[model samples]
Structures are given as structure tokens and as C-alpha cells.
Target: MGGAMAVRVAAAGHTLTVFNRTRAAAEAVATRCPVDVTVAGTAREAAAAADVVVVSLADDAAARATYGGSDGLVAGLAAGAVVADTSTVAPETTRALEADVRSAGGLLADTPVSGSVSSVEGGTVLVMAGGSAEAVERAAPALESFAQRIIHLGPLGSGATMKLAVNAMVFGLNQTLAEALVLAEKSGVARELAYEVIANSAVAAPFVHYKRAAFEHPESAPVAFALDLVAKDLDLATALATQVGAPVPQVELNRRIVGDAIAAGRGAEDLSALAEHLRG
Candidate 1:
């Protein structure tokens, strides 16, 4: 996903210097784009050279690793540099990261995006950005190259919070859809008829429509979103719920189901693999 976003940014004519823990993967991504991307040896080197630095790590710990340390991105940021963090984490953590950037005379914008790899490649992903209006505006031209909708939600960590909220609905719906399909198939209803009915039902979401192929062919559905990532997002969601004293019984149940999916070693599979998990 980071690689794809880089391609999009470069395509938009933004000069890019990419950093990755694995140099080969970064080079592989560079090869996919016609734009010449500078390959930096260290995060500091990359952040030092760019006015707008985007960090697209997988989790909070990874985000800190990418942005922390004495020689990390924050260590070498130039004044007025805008650091865009594209990770799903706790709002408080993002705010803390923002403080680090601010101390270095730079800004941190928490930009958690939603959509599949295709959406990213096609420059149609929804970006939930959080930070000062000025910083978001400064990053807008670059963000517009990769996102269809750029929403500046609020101060630091708003994007992360919004992403968690959105994932709750997304994963919950996915789990429910899987269970519905499992129930229908086991109760003598033809799988085709069940899908046909559900696809046309009022409860059907665009996501359900998109995963129709996965529903029919769980073994072959392209992995747009993996189950392990779903579990991560759910973990963030549950934590957020607890912090706010909100009860999310359904989300809690879905989290356990995702844990089951992970325990079955389906973590690397497409999230639609839940149906296959449920079938077993």
C-alpha cells in the first residue's frame, strides 16, 4: 500500500525520496513508476530532503520506529516540513508523535486512509486527515494525487479515530455477511440463490457487492484486505470503545471471531476468507 501510494504521489509530479526497512521492496516499487524516485538509505536522509514526508507503516509500533529514534524522520526534519503519518493507531499516540514533530519545528498530520489497493492505484481512496488546517492544506496538493476525498477531521489523531470508527462498521458488516452466507449454505439454501437475494436486499452495502466474487470463490478472491489487518483495526476499535466507556458488544464478538480466523492461520488470507473460516 505504501508503494502504491508512492507511485501515485510521483505520478502527481511530486519529487519523492522513499525509505523502507527492506531496500529491495522500495526499489521494486520505484521500478513500477516512470518517475525517478530517490532511494534513501535512512529515514532521516529521506525526511531531511523532503518538505512533505509521508510515513506509511503498518501499526503504531512501526509508526514510532519509523518516526522516532535519534536518527529517525523526526530527528532530521527541516522547519515547516509537514510529516504525514498514514497509520492506524490511538489518537493519543498520534498526538504524542505530533508533539515530537512540533518540537523539531515540523508538523505531523495523521492521515489514515480507507479503500482497497485498487482505489489507491486509481487515486480514489478516502483520506481522513488530522492536524492544523494549514498543515493539511500544505499537504493537500500531494494528498490529492492519491486520494479522492481528503477530509481534515480535526486536531492530531482525529484521522486515526475516524479510521477506527469506520473499520468497526466495515468489519462488523463483513463478519455478519460471512455468518449469513454460512447459515444460508448450511440450511439447504442454494449458495447462488442466497447471494442473489442478499445482493438485492436493502441491507446490502457497496462492500458486500464488491466482495461478491470472494463469496463465490473464497479460494481465488484477490486479497484486497487481509484478516490480520482486520484484527488489528478491531483491536484499535475495541480499545477506543473502552477508552470512551462505550459498549460495543457486537464489535467485541466480531473481534473474537477475527481472533478465531487468525488462530486458524487465515491471517494472511483475504478478509473474505472469513466465510471459509466460518464454513470450517
Candidate 2:
């Protein structure tokens, strides 16, 4: 996702320096754009030199590890540099990171993206951001290059909260789709016929519509968003619910189902592979 965003930004005439734990991955991303792409040896090196530094790591632990230490972005960034975090981290972590960036005389913006690889490649992702109006305005043009819809939710950590809420719905819907397909197949209905019927129904959605091929083949192409990542997002959603004292029973259930799937060694598969469990 970060690589795709960087590609879009660079294509839009913004220079970018990328840092990844794997140098090859960073180089691979940089090779796609005709920009002054500096492959940094560490996060700090990348952050120190960039005007607007974007961190797009896996989770909170990874985000913190990339910025919390002396060699992290926080220590190496110039004063007044804008730090845009694109990682899906906890709201508290976003708040803390924002404070830390401010303490260092830098600004932080929490901007989480929503889309699959295809959507990102097409520059149609939805971006929800939370930060100061000035910071958001500063980042808007660059963000606009990659997002079809960019909404400023509120201040500081609202983007993270909004992202969690959105993922909760996605997780639930994916699970519901899996169960529905499983039930239909078990009832001796042809998978293709079931999909045709559902695709014409009111319940048919973009999610189900897109996954129809996967439902038919079961073992289709490589997974774009792996089940482990889905599980991680669900875990984040569940944690967010608990932090805000909201009872998300449905989210909790979906978390367990994804968790069980991951534990069963299906973590690397597409989230739609949840149908395999339902087939049992």
C-alpha cells in the first residue's frame, strides 16, 4: 500500500525517499518512478532528509520500533517537518506519536488509507485523516494524488478511530459473505448459480461481487490482502472498541474466526479463504 502511494505521489511530481527493512523492497518501489529516489539505510536517514515524511509500517509495534528509538524518525527529523503516518495503528499510539513529533518541533498527521491493491494502483483509495487544519492542508495536495476521496475526520487520533470503525464493518461483511456462500454450497446449490443469484440480490455488494471468482475456484490466485493482515486489523478493531468502552460483539466474533483461521495455518491465504473453515 505504501509503495503504491509513493508511486502515485512521485508520479504527481513529488520527490520521495523510501526506507524499508528490506533494501530490495525499497529499491523495487523506487524503480517504478522517475524521481530522485533515495533508498535510506534506516528510517532516520529517510526522515531526516524528507520534507514530508510518511511512515507506512505493519502495525503499532512496527511503527513504534521505526520511530521510538534514537535511530527512529522522531530523532532524525528536522524541526517543522511534517510526519504523515499511514500505518493502521491504535488511536492512543497515534496521539502519543503526535505528541512526540510536536515535542520535537515537528507536526504529525494520522492519515490512514482504505483500498485493496487494485484500488490503490488505480489511485482511487479513500483517505481519512486526523490532524490540525494547517497540517492537513499542507498534506492535501500530495494526498490527493493517491486518493479519490480524502476526508478530514477531526483532530489528532480520529483518523485511527474512523479506520477501526471502517475495518469492523469490512471484517463483519467478509465473514458474513463467507458464511452465506458456504451455506449455499452445502445446500447442494452450484457455486456459480449461487453467486449469480446473490449478485442479483440486494445483499450483493462490491465485496461479494469481486470475490465471486474466489468463491468458485476456492484456490484461486495469490491473496492480495492475506488473512493474517485481516486478523491484525480485526484485533485492532476489537482493541479500539474496548478502549472506547463500546460493545462490539460481532467484531469480537469475527476476530475469533479470523484468529482461528490464522492459527490453522491459513494466515497467508486470502481472507475469503475463511470459506474453507465454513466448509467443515
Candidate 3:
């Protein structure tokens, strides 16, 4: 996802520099773009070179690691720089990171995005941005590089909150769709035909349209969103729900189903593989 976003940013004529824990991964991103992308050895080096730095790490832990150390991105940031963090983490994590960036004379926006690789490639992902209007506006050009739409939710961690809400729906839909598909198959309905009806029905969301190949041929389709990541997102969602005194019983159930699939060693499979997990 990070690599795809880099390609989109570069395609938008932004001067881009990439840094990944794995040098080869950074190199791969550079190779994908026709423009010159400087491959930096450290997060600090990359952050120092840009006024607006967009971060897309794996999770909260990775986000902390990239922004916390003495030679971190915050340390290398020029004064008044804007940092857009696109990782899906708890609101608390973003709040803490925002403080760190603010202390360093920089602005941080919790700009978690919603979309898959195709959306990134096409520069059509939805960005849920949370920050002061000034900070979010400062980061708009870079965010606009890869986002089709950007919604400024509110201050601090609002983007994370909205992202979790969106994922809660996505995960619940995934589980219900899996069950519906498996139920149809077991009840003598053809798998493809059932999917056809589902896709054409009122529930034919963008996720369903893009995920058709994965659901129809779980074994052959590339993993768009891994189950392990889905579990992680579910954990964030449930934790947020608890923090705000909200009830997410459906997400809680989806978490258990995802946990069971992970325990069975299908953690690395696509989320659509939930259908196969249910078939067994």
C-alpha cells in the first residue's frame, strides 16, 4: 500500500523520497515510478527532505518506532512542517504522536485512508483527515496526490475514530457475506450465481465489486487485505468502542471469527479467505 501510494504521489509530480525498513522495498517503490525518487536510509533523512511528509506504516507500533527515536522523523523535521500519518491506529496513539510533532514545531494530521491497492493506484482513496484546519490544509496537496476525496472530521484523532467506524462496517460485512455465500453453497445454490445476486443487490458496495475475484477464487486471487490486518483493525475498533462507551457487538463477534481463522494458520490469507475458513 505504501509503495502504491508513493507511485501515485510521484505520478502527481511531487518530489518524493521513500524510506522503508527493508531497503529493497524502498527500491521497489522507486523502480515503479518514472520520476526520480530518492531512496533514504532513515526516516529522518526522508522527513528532512520534504515540507509535507506522508507516513503509511503497518500499525501503531511501527508508527511509534518511526517517529519516536532521537533520529526519528520528528527530529529531522524542519520547523512548521506538516506530517500526515496514514496508519490505522487508536485515537490515543495519534493524539500522542500529534503532541510529539507539535513539540518539535511541526503539525501532524491523523489522515487514515480507506481503499485498496487499486484505489491508491488510481488516486481515488478516501482520506479521513483529523487536525486543525491549518494543519490539514498544509498537508492537503500531498494528501490530494493520492486521495479522491478528503473529509476533515475534526481535531486530533477524529480521523482514526472515523476509520475504525468504517472498518467495523467492512469487517462485519465481510463476515456476513462469507456466511451468506457459504450458506448458499451448502444449501445447493451455485457459488458464482449466489455471488452474482449479492453483487447486484442493494448490498453491492465498492468492496464487494473489487473483492469479487478474491471471493470467487480465494485460492488464486491476490490478497488485497490480509486477515491478520483485519484482526488488528478489529482490535482497534473494539478498543475504541470501549473507550467511548459505545456498543459494537457485531464487531466483537467478527473479531472472534477472525481470531479463529488466525489460530488455524490462515492469518496471512486475504480477508476474503474467510469464506474458505467458513466452508470448513
Candidate 4:
């Protein structure tokens, strides 16, 4: 998604300074970008070069790592820079980082995104941004290069909270779809046929449309979103529910199913692999 976002931003005619955990991965993204892309050696270097810095990482730990330390992004941020973090992390994490960035003379926004890699490449992803109005506005140009829809959702950490909520629904839908598909197959309906009807049915979602290949042909479909990542997201979501004293029975069940799949060594598979797990 970071690579795709880089390409999309470059396609929009913005020069970028790209940095990844791996230097080679950053170089690869630079090669794919249409506009000039400087591959930065460190997160700090990348942050120093841009008015708006976009950080896309795996989780809260990665986000914290990339933004801390002597050579981290916070150390090299240009004063008054707007840093938009696109990682799906705990709201607490985002709010903590926001303070660090603030003290460094920069603003930070939790700008979690929604949509697949293809949607990112096509510049159709949705961005849910949370920050002060000034900060969100400053980050909009960078986010708009890749996101067709960008919503400013109040102060810091709002995007992270909303992302957790959205993902809870997503995981629930995935679980239900897997169960429904397995039930259909056991009742003699073809997997492909069942998926087709589901994709067109009243319950059809954007995810159902894009996940067709993975659900119908798991063996060949690429791992767009891995089951391990799904498990991680569920973990964050369920944790947030507990923190807020909310009863999320269905999300807990989804988390357990994902945990079981991971325990069975299917963690690296696509989320759609749940159907196969359920079939067993």
C-alpha cells in the first residue's frame, strides 16, 4: 500500500522522498513512481525533505519505532510540517505520537485509509483524517494525491478510532461471508456460483466485490491482505472494545476464528482463506 501510494502521489505530479524499513523496498518504489522520487536513507531524512510527511507502517510498534529515536522522523521534521500517519494502530498510540510531533514544532494527524492496493493505485481510497483543522488541511494535498475521498473527523486519534470501528464491521462481514459460502458449498452450490450471487446480493460490499478472486480461487489469488494482519486488526478492535466497556460478542468470535486459522499455520494466507478453514 505504501508503494502504491508513492506511485499514485508521483502520478499526481508530486515529487516524493520515499523511505521504507528496507532501503531496497524504497528504491523499488522510487523506480515505479512516475515523478522524481528520492530514496531517503532514514525516516528523519525523509521527514526533513517534505512539508507533509506520510508514514505508513504495519502497526503501533512500527509507527512508534519510525517516529522515535535520535534519527527518527520526529528528530528531522521541518518546523510546522504536517505528518500524516496512515497506520492502523490504537488511538492511544496516535495521541501519544501527536504530542511528540507537536513538541517538535510539527502537527500530526492520524490518517488511516480504507480500500485495497488496486484502489490505492487507482487513486480511489478513502482517507479518514483526525487532527486540528489546520493540520488536516495541511495534510490534505498529500493525501488527496492518492485518496479520492478524504474526511476530516475531528481531533487527533479520531481516525484511528473510526478505523477500528470500520475494521470490526469488515472482519464480521468476512466471517459471515466465509460461513455463508461454506454452507452453500455443503448444500451443493458451486463455490464460484455462490460467490457470484453473494457479490450481487443485497449484502454485497466493496470488499466482497474486490475479494472475489481470493474467495473463489484462494490458491492463485494474491495475498492482498494476509490473515495474520486480519488477526492483528481484530486484536486491536477487540482491545478497543474492552477499553470502552463495549460488548462485542461477534467481533470476539471473529477474532477467535482468525486466531484458530493462524494457529493452524494459515496465518500467511489471504483473509478469504477463512472459507477453507471453515470448510474443514
Candidate 5:
């Protein structure tokens, strides 16, 4: 996601300094970007001289490690600089980071993204942001370069909450579709025929259509979103529900199914591989 966002930003003629856990990966992404790009040695170095520093790491632990300590982004960001996080982390983490950044004389915003790699590459991702109105306005133009829809959900943590809600629904619908596809296969229906029937019916949804090609030709290509990442997202979503006192039995069940898929060595496979689990 970070790589995709960086590509969009650079393609729009913005200079970029990137930092990655792997130098090779950072350089690789930089080579594809259109502007002058520098690969920083650490997160703090990446944030130090930038007007707006965007962090798009994996989770809370990674985000905290990058910005919380003495050698982190919090220590290096200039006063009045904006620290925007695009990670799908806990809302509490977002709130805490916002407070911390403000204490350090910088602004913060939680702006999580929705849509797949294709959507991101096409600059059509939906951005759900949570921050003060002024901050949202300040970030709008750059965000708009990459997002087709940018919604200011509410204050500090609302974006993270909204992202979790979106992921939960996505996981539930994806699991249902995986099961339905497997059932159709077992009934000897051609996979393409099954997908066509569903796509023509009211039961069809964006998720179903998105995974249609994968369901039709299971072994045809590499998976874009791996199973392990989906499992991690589901776990985060489940935790979010618990924090909000929302009961999500079906989400929990889907989490377990995802966990099982990962445990069965499908972690690196595309999530559409969940159809294999349903077949068993």
C-alpha cells in the first residue's frame, strides 16, 4: 500500500524519500516512481525533512517502533509538519499517535485506505480520514491525487474504526462467496458458469465479482492479497469490535477460518484460496 501510494505521489510530480525495512524493496519502488526519489536509512530520516510524512507500515507495533521512541519520527519531525498514518491499526493507537504528534508540535491524521492493488495503482482508492477539519483540508489535495473518494469520517480515531467496519463486511462476504463457489463446483457446475450466474443475480456483490477470475481459474496466477495479511486484518477487525462492545460472532468464525487457512500453509497464497478450505 505504501509503495502504491508513493508511486502515485511521485507520478504526480512530488519528490519522495522512502524508507523500508528492506532497502532493496524501497529502491525498487523508488525506481518505478516518476519524481526525484531518495531511499532513507530509517523512518526518522524519512520523516525529518519532509513537509508531510506518511507512515504506511503493518500494525501498531511497527508504527510505534517507527515513531514512538527517541530515535523515531516523533523525535525528528519539524514543528507544523503533518504526520499522516495510512496503516490499518487500532483506533487507540491512532488517537495516541495524534496526541503524541501534537505534543511534539506536529499535526497528525489517521487516513486509512480501501480498495485493492489495482484500484490503488489506478488512483481510485477510497480514503477514510479522521482528524480536525483543518487538518483534513490541509491533506486533501495530496490525498485526492491518489483517492477517488476522500471522506472525513470524524475526529482522530474514526478513520480506523471505519476501516475495521469495512474489512469485517469484506471478510464476511468473501467467506460466503468462497463457500458458495466451492458448493457450485461440487455440484459439477463449471466455475465460470457459476460465477456468471451469481454475477447476474441479486446476490452478486463487488467482492464476488472481484474474486471471479481467481475462482474460475484457481491456479492461473499469483495471489495479489495473501492469506496471512487477510488473517491479520481480520484479527485487527475482531479486536476493534471487542473494543466497541460490538458482538461479531460471524466475524470471529471467519477469523478462525482464515487462521485455519494460514495454518495449513496457505499463508502466502491469495485469499481466494479459501475456496480450497470450503471444499474440504
Candidate 6:
């Protein structure tokens, strides 16, 4: 996701400095960007050199490691700089990071996004940003360059919480669709035919159409969104629901299904693989 954004930013005539845990990956991204992209040695160095530092990591541990380490991004940020994170994590985690950046005289916002890789590349993703109005405004230009719709949702953690909500519904819907598809196949319908019908059906979401190929042939499904990542997102969503007074029965059930799918060695596969697993 970071790599895609960097390319888009570079294409938009913005000077982007990029950093990756793997030096070679960063170098590779730099070469592919249409415009020149400077590669920074570390997150700290990248933050130090830029006024607006954007980070999108895998999870809470990776995020904390990058932003809390001795030579972390937060430590090197300039005063009044805006540091934004696009990871989908617990709301409290975002608040904590917000406090850390604010204490260091920088602004922090949680800006989780929605849409597939194609949408991201097309710069048509919806960005749910959470922070003060001032901070959201400060990050608008960069966000606008990559996002077609940007919603500044209230304060810190709000964006992440909303993202968690969105994710729960989406992944749960996919899992339910997987079950329905499997049922259809077992009830004397061809999987391919079933997928075509669903893709054109009234209830079909854009995501369903996007994953039609994967749903029909899970064996070689492209890993646009991996099973493990969505599983982790579901776990976060479940935790949030439990914390709040919401009874998400479907989310809990879908969480177990995703866990089973991951345990069945489909962790690295596209989440549409869940249909294959369910059919099994």
C-alpha cells in the first residue's frame, strides 16, 4: 500500500522519500516511481527529512516498533510536522500514538483507507481520517492526491474505529458469501455459473465482482488481500466490539471461520480461498 501511494505521489509531481524494512524493496520502489523517489535509510531519517511523514505498516507491533524505537519516526519529526498512519489498528492504539506525536510537537492522524488495490492505484479509495480539523486540513493535499473521497471523522481514533467497523462488515459479508457459494455448488450448481450469477445479482457488492475470478477458482486466486491480514483485522474488530456494548454475533462467527481458513494453510492466499476451504 505504501509503495502504491509513493508511486502515485511521485506521478503527481511530488518529491517522495520512501523507507522499507528491507532496503532492496525500497530501492526497487524508487526505480519504479515515474518521478525520482529518494530512498531513506530508516524511518527516522525519512521523518527527519520531510514535513509530512506517512506510515502504513502491517500491524500494531510493527507500527509500534517503527514509531517507538530509539530512531523512530516520532523521535525525528520536526515541530508542527504532521505524521499520519494508515494502518487499521485498535482505536486506543491510535490515540496512544497520537499522544506520542503530539507530545513531540507533531500532529498525528489515523487515516485508514477502503478499496482494493485497483481502487488504490486509481486513486479512488475512500480515506477515513481522524484528528483535529486543523490536522486533517494539513494532510488534505497528500490524501487528496491518493483518495477520491476523504472523510474527516471527528477526533483521534475515530477513523480507526470506523475502519474496524467497515472491515467487520466487509469481511463478514465475504465469509457469508463464501458459505453461500459453497452451498450453491453442493446443491447441484456449477461454481463458475454461481459466481457469474452472484456477480451480476442485485445483492452483489463491488468487492464480489472484483473477486469473481478468485471466488470461482481459489487455487490460483491472486493475493490482492491475504487471508491472514483480513483475519487479523477481524480479530481487531471483534476486540473493539467486545469493548463497546455491541453484540456482533456474525462477526464472532466469521472470526472463527477465518481462523479455520488460516489454520488450513490458506493464510497467504486470497481471502476468496475461504470459499474453497468452506467447500472442503
Using Cα atoms with residue i matched to residue i, what is each candidate's TM-score against the true structure? 0.93, 0.92, 0.98, 0.98, 0.93, 0.96
Candidate 2 lDDT over 5-93, as tens digits, reads 88888888887888898889999999987676788988888888887887788898898888878878988888988987878888999
Better of 1 and 2 by TM-score: 1
Which regions of candidate 1 are displaced past 4 Å?
Answer: 188-193
Candidate 1 local distance difference test against the native: 0.88
Off by over 4 Å in 5: none
Whole-model lDDT values for every prediction: 0.88, 0.84, 0.92, 0.91, 0.84, 0.85
Expressed as tens digits, the lDDT of each residue in 27-82 for candidate 5 is 99998888779998877788787878877887888888888777689888888888
lDDT of 4 by residue, 87-178 (tens): 99999999999889989999999999989899898888999989999998988988999899999989898999999999889888989999
Question: Could you tell which candidate, 4 or 6, scores higher by lDDT?
Answer: 4
List model 6 lDDT by residue over 250-273, tens digit each.
888887888888888989888888
Tens-digit lDDT string for candidate 3 (1-280): 8899899889889999999988899998999997988999999999999899999988899999999897689988989899999999999999999888899899999999998889888888999999999989999998898899999999989999999999999998889899999999999999999999999999999888888889998879897788999999999999888988999999999999999999999999999999999999
Better by lDDT, candidate 4 or 3: 3
The count of residue-pair clashes in candidate 6 stands at: 0
Tell me the deviation in Å of residue 94 in model 4: 0.3
Best-matching candidate per lDDT: 3
The residue pairs that clash in candidate 2, if any, are none
Better of 2 and 4 by lDDT: 4
- For model 5, how big is the CA root-mean-square deviation? 1.7
lDDT value, residue 65 of candidate 6 = 88
lDDT of 1 by residue, 62-153 (tens): 87887889769998899999988877788888988888899999988998898767778988889999999988998888888889999999
Report the CA-based lDDT of candidate 6 relative to the real structure: 0.85
Worst 10 residues of 4 by lDDT: 6-15
